[model samples]
Target chain A: MAVAAVRRLAATAPVPVFVARGGGTGLLPVELAFDARLRLVVSPRHATVLVAAGRFPGPLGVAVDRVHDQLPAPRGTLWWTADVDGDRPAALRDASVVTDADPVGSVVALHRDLCLGRIRSDAAVLADDPPNRFEGRGDHGQGGEGMMGGVPWGRPMAMTGDDRDGLALDRLPVVLGPFLPGFPNGLRVHAVLQGDVVQEAKLEVLDLGSGPRLDRLDPAAGGAQHDLRWLAEALRLAGLGALAVRAARLARAAPAPASRAALARLVRRSGLPAAWSGVGVIDGEDARARLVRRLDPSAPEGRSPGPSLERVAEVLVGQDWSDAVVTICSFDLPTDRAEAVIEAQA
Target chain B: MTAQAEVWAAPLLTAGVLAAGAYVVAVLDAAVAAAVSGAGIGRSVLAGPLRRAALLVVQQPSATERPDAASWALAPALYAGLAAAGLAVIPWSASFSVADVEAGIVLWGTVESLAIVAIFLHGWSANTHQSLLAAYRFLAAGLSYLLLSMFVLIAAAIPAESLQLSRIVESQHGLWNVVRQPLGLPLFAVVALGSSTWGPLNLADGDDLSGGTTADVSGRPRLVWSGARAAMLTSFSAMAATVFLGGWQGPVLPGPAWVVLKTLVVLAALVASGHLFARVRTERFVTVCWLVLLPLAFLDLVIAGVEAL
Candidate 1:
């Protein structure tokens, strides 16, 4: 009886969704923001449903597979625009694949079915093997040479290195996100971190297909809506969920001057502008200034667009991970152009 | 029942009450947080904890590569146990404490200190860079709050002249600590939020680290860890009520009812504060705690001491 009750409750809970964006699928975020039943989570671990929206390049297939494996069991995946192909996991073969249709309704339906136990969740696709095999050469067979330094289980132990703050600490290399929350879709960074500080960064840009360019949109309608989307994402990253939601709502409402002013007032009252004032300055305007300028209709078109991923990596080197996220979100880089530059650089 | 039987059963009953209270507090916290964030309070809001509980129950437990599996599994239960132990000394009414020792205040303090260690274990055992970073961040952030908590708790105890929580409540019969020591309640509230790692003080599971210590945790273990966090917040709010607002003391209501009322109020305030402020950077938060909150707490303690004399 208790088990049945628990199952019912689980079915009713807000669906935790993790979205992976493909090229030109900016409309999905707007749709998700308007949906009250869905809760957009930052990490795959927290998600019950992994929604892969838009085109998935061939290169990102393995990365997508890794993300798919990361979700806990009794989980489902919704392929909004693209389907897994060639060496795909068996579980994903049976996954919900939505192509060339309105994905919002289908995604919601998938979540409902998943929670209701109407659909059996995908099983683990990857083998349940440890990341590294332990073959240490020691008396106890504990991997490594000396007490402080050695490779353990085919992975080298992080050795002490000089940090940005001048403190010597063990530096660990981590790959953060092609699908990480609070980052632009397909932007992955290889970072060497000392504690929480980024000591060094390398950029990897996945080439998802190009979508509608923001610059081509009508300045009165699409431009205001586009700017609001950036503001919403920035607010969400800063742990300001309510404000983010409000911004999204403002974007949906007529895209009028009155609504825009209200959105600006909401941003100011949120105290986020003041808090983000000096953090992550781009083109001489900090994150707060950029956000404010985006909200204003009369603000001049200033500075050349499309800061390279390498430039972003340079800016991120010494900043705390939290500040770095804000910095990255502050710049509205055209995804297609950025991808082109990244490919050229490579 | 015999005296010995009563002694044995008293703790068992108190444990049940604390567990129930913790569940209630968690639900109420969700409601209040949603309401304050402009998400209208509804029947659906109440379903959140239940739904999360159900989801966690059915999901499989996951581990990172080369994780300390034993320690990883142990941390959540250990955290919850410490929270339950802290609740043991908090008297529901004058005669309703599970373990009303002579040094009950000190006992609560020790449990809180152990919570820091337990959280560190949870983060470190994950074997992920983000998790380890979160663990270290908690240690750095935990220090300032720990000192602030001790000073505030000691300040509250100074007027009572007894470490016993019941005695402390009795001392507030004439005037509550919030009235007598102006800075005491706010200081204790801040410390409680920090100690429980909730709201602005939730650096251990903050967004920057993508859920931080809990980044890799899922299934039943995740439920336990999150529930333990909620339980810790409930316990802290109860302690705050007991220490400063005159626990179980009210004009018209029964003693237990008053204790329950005050606890809910404090819990509501804590949850509301969580939605009000964005997370502060760890270094800046530490600086503010030490430079501003510490000196203010010290001054409050001195004032309490003077009043006691």
Candidate 2:
């Protein structure tokens, strides 16, 4: 009886969905932001439903499969795509598909069915085994030759490096997301870190030949609508989810002068501008300046094109992890143009 | 009441209060978030936490490749246990408390320090870089605020001339420490925020590293971690009430009721602060804690000493 009660209560919970965003999924975020029935989780581990949203062409689908396996048991997947009938990723071949404008209802139903045992949880897409063999080639078998360096299970141990303080410390290398929370969907960073400070960093953009641009779904997503969308994402990255939701709601409706002014006041009162001041300075402008400008009604309509990813990476060096993330999110890079540049280089 | 009744009743009371406090913290968080987002206060705000907890129960936890599974599970339990230990020191009424030791303030201090270990273990046991980075970042920042807490607590202990929390509450009968040492409550609030890792001090489980320490945690374990955090916040509020706000002292209402009401107010203030402010950068926060807040805490301690003289 208690088990049944738990299931009933679980069904009433808002569906915790982790969205593996593919290209051209701009509208999905705005829709999910205000939908009380669905909660967009930052991590796959925290999610019950893994929604593979938008177009995942080629290798991106493999990344989605990896994310799918990260979800805990009693998990389900839904494919929310524009071209549902054309071709589905192998991971979503037998999964439920939604072609609707808003996939909240579908996600909610999927969560409820899973809770009530009406449908079986999806099986793991990848094998349940370690990626590399566990072996050591050191004197004490601690990985390195003497005591402090070697790959244990294909994962490199942190090596000593000169830190900002002129002290030697272990420097660990990390690759932050293509699908990482607080980052633009396709943006990734490869960084060597000493403690939480980034020692060296570089941008790694994914190939997007398989999918359309992010803004292709909505041609009207420019000017005020565009800035608002960016503001919402920036707010979320800053750990202000409530404000992000407010920004998203504003973006969804026709913008009014009064509402925009109120939001700007609220933003200032929240101390975001203060916290973000002097953070992630690029060229001559800091994050605070850019954020304030975006909220300024008469400042400008279109944003200036952002610096190249390589140039941005140069700025990322020596910043703390949190500041680096906020810095990356501050720029207004056109994904299509960035992709084009990468393609040209190739 | 008989000794046998006291034995059973004391634990029951403390557990019941802690559970209620934690639940209220969660509900208050949801309500504050809703209000901040312009979603409005609704019945759903209250029910949200319960429903989410139920979902966590029904879901299954994920396993990382080669995590310290024992510590991964033990982390939340240890964290929650520390919160309970902190709560156990505060007397509900003059005659009631689980363990009103002579050095209850010291006991609470120990709980605050040990929480750093519990939080670090939660992140490090995951065997993931982001989690490990969070753990490291927390350690670097934790020491700064912890010292501030010590100063604040010692300042509150000056007039009472006793390390006992109940005595401190009794001492506040003349004039609350919040008024006596005006900087005491706000400085101690920073300690509360830092020890619990909530609001601007939420470096361990922040959004930039994708939930940071909690990045790879989910399901039942996630529920425990979340609850443990809320419980810790509740414990801090209760401690703040006891230390500065005159725990169970008020006119008209019963002593225990006064304690409960004061705790709720502190808890609400903490939760609202969590929603209202953007996360401060880690390096910046650590700098402020040491350079600015630490000096203010010293000033508060000096004030309390002057008053005692």
Candidate 3:
């Protein structure tokens, strides 16, 4: 029953959508497959069958980011035309877009929520996570408007697990944290493979930030330039329709090869079958991303479908898809290979 | 143009008041946090880079760090910059104007585009993931808002028949196009807010998902950017409110005063809506916009087209 419940949710839950950072320079699906450090959360609610994936927003942001930037940036991005992308810009004037968060509320009620809703009951005690910067909207006096005046920097922090525990974090409730500095918020999951088997399992929460904060699809695990570019488009969208989730259970998923050779290469380069961890739904961001590869049509699908594949054999064998609850798994996908497989399967 | 600009004191004054007021509150809010929160991780990020970085771990970035708050103020600041440029174009009593051109509409739009670049730059400078995320949201939002806003101008040009503000207003004398094209009023208003990146539509700045773009910003630039953006946002909203609502089209009251009153009310409504729904997630905001307002705006446009026919 629990499995069924999980399956139902897996089938029905919103899958976040991601746009692969495409350019003429082109992204290599193989390299992303080898990055063991990056993990992804898939989008299941978009019009297209694409995954809006986010990498692990974790402590080692600085180091991981260094590896990502090692790549030469791409240029000449693609454009969405009328109909291809939704709405003409003129359709946007006059009406200010608003959405239903709670069933309904009067202005006053909304005001109350703005101040107190979604807050932990003990918010006052939660290690005061600081009031959001109100656009330097604070009363900084006349001197507040100075520009180019060397804005001061804060001290570096240590995101150690033990240190985090020692802090007054207990006072606060858990909320979506930002992506580790290096990760992007909206990344596309390319491919998911273990040895030669294409088991359809998905990773759910690689949010660069938590679920609540997401609306528009972003390049998963994005950086400053990415944010600016994304927000520009977001401003145009009326609904904060978050990155749409694409299906991922037969439903079968980061960045680049670094100074540390890609994990896939670690095993491949070693001339060995990558040590297989029989895939069950395992947790941890990096662990999942370890083998997401660029599927070479030339390489072929897991026709053998493996011994571990038998684990779900009862579930897979001859059950009509009509009664079957197709669970969607999210991950980092390479554009070419993902397209090739869908086309072949379709 | 006089009809639209009567060059009222109200938009100027009201915009000033709104911007200054928001600015003051922002500043005070900062001092309050500083004093109340005491000297732990909050102070200035200057105290320690790691402390600042640690503070960034939580998705919800707040005003504890002065730079964070300053960065928070970026969108508004860009708004202010746009306002300064656009405001220069509004004709005061027709006799005097900052930049009266054959292409006033296009002109202001050009000026406004600069703000997007500013925003992108701000996000980059912040050097944080959430800030960058916010920047991307800003970029996506801008693409649509700019395109639609320009479209609204095209619709307005129907009756005016000219791009020049004076000519547009002159064309509207017999009966304001607003009565004929009521849909553009509110539709443009929505576009205006979206462009401004103000309240109800402020998902890009949300601390939860994107960590408020420009989260690590601080000091004087924060003030300028914050106040400037609010001024610009309110002014543009006021500008559109005046133009679409008939550019001082009310009864009895003088054109300028009436326009200001109308604009102020509209701005207040927009700001209040934002305050009311600021806490809603980005998706919810987007959904409400897509599900509700977009359709309504289209309906208005359809009705106008029928009237025009």
Among these predicted structures, which one has the highest lDDT?
A: 2
lDDT over C-alpha atoms for residue A59 of model 2 = 66
| Pairs of residues at least 3 apart in sequence or in different chains that clash in candidate 1 | A24-A211
Candidate 2, residues A1-346, lDDT tens digits: the string is 9999999999999888888877656434644777778887778888889998777766677778888888887899988876665445667877888777667888899899999999999888877665666455677575676666676655667889789889999988777777876566567788998877899998976654444333432334346777777787777767787888888888877678788888888788778888888987877898898889888766655466688988889888888777888888787556534233333556
- lDDT tens readout by residue for model 1, B1-309: 699898888767756765676678667766754554345777866667777778888777886787999999999889988888888888878777778888998898899889998999999999986677778878888888788777888898898899999999999998998898879889888777777787767878876677889989988999889888888888888898888899988898888888888988898888766656666667777888899999998998898888778
Q: C-alpha displacement of A155 in model 1, angstroms?
A: 5.8
Q: What lDDT does model 3 reach? A: 0.36
Poorly placed runs, candidate 1 (over 4 Å): A1-5, A82-93, A99-102, A127-156, A164-168, A211-219, A255-271, A282-284, A292-306, A336-346, B1-12, B36-39
lDDT of 3 by residue, A1-346 (tens): 5433332322221111122321110122111211111112111111111111222233223222322222111101111111122221221111122222211122222222222222221112113233332234224421223331112232222111222225321111111211221112322212222111222322222323222221222233222212222221221121211110001100002222231122223223321112111222323322113223211112223111112322333332222111111111111122112222333556
- Chain A (candidate 1) TM-score to true chain A: 0.83
* Candidate RMSDs in order: 4.1, 2.9, 23.4
Better of 2 and 3 by lDDT: 2
Shift in Å, residue B43, candidate 3:
28
Q: Residue A263 in model 2: shift from native, Å?
A: 1.6
DockQ (C-alpha based) per candidate is 0.45, 0.73, 0.01
The full ranking of all candidates by TM-score, starting with the best, is 2, 1, 3
lDDT of 1 by residue, A108-143 (tens): 777667767898887777676546655556443545
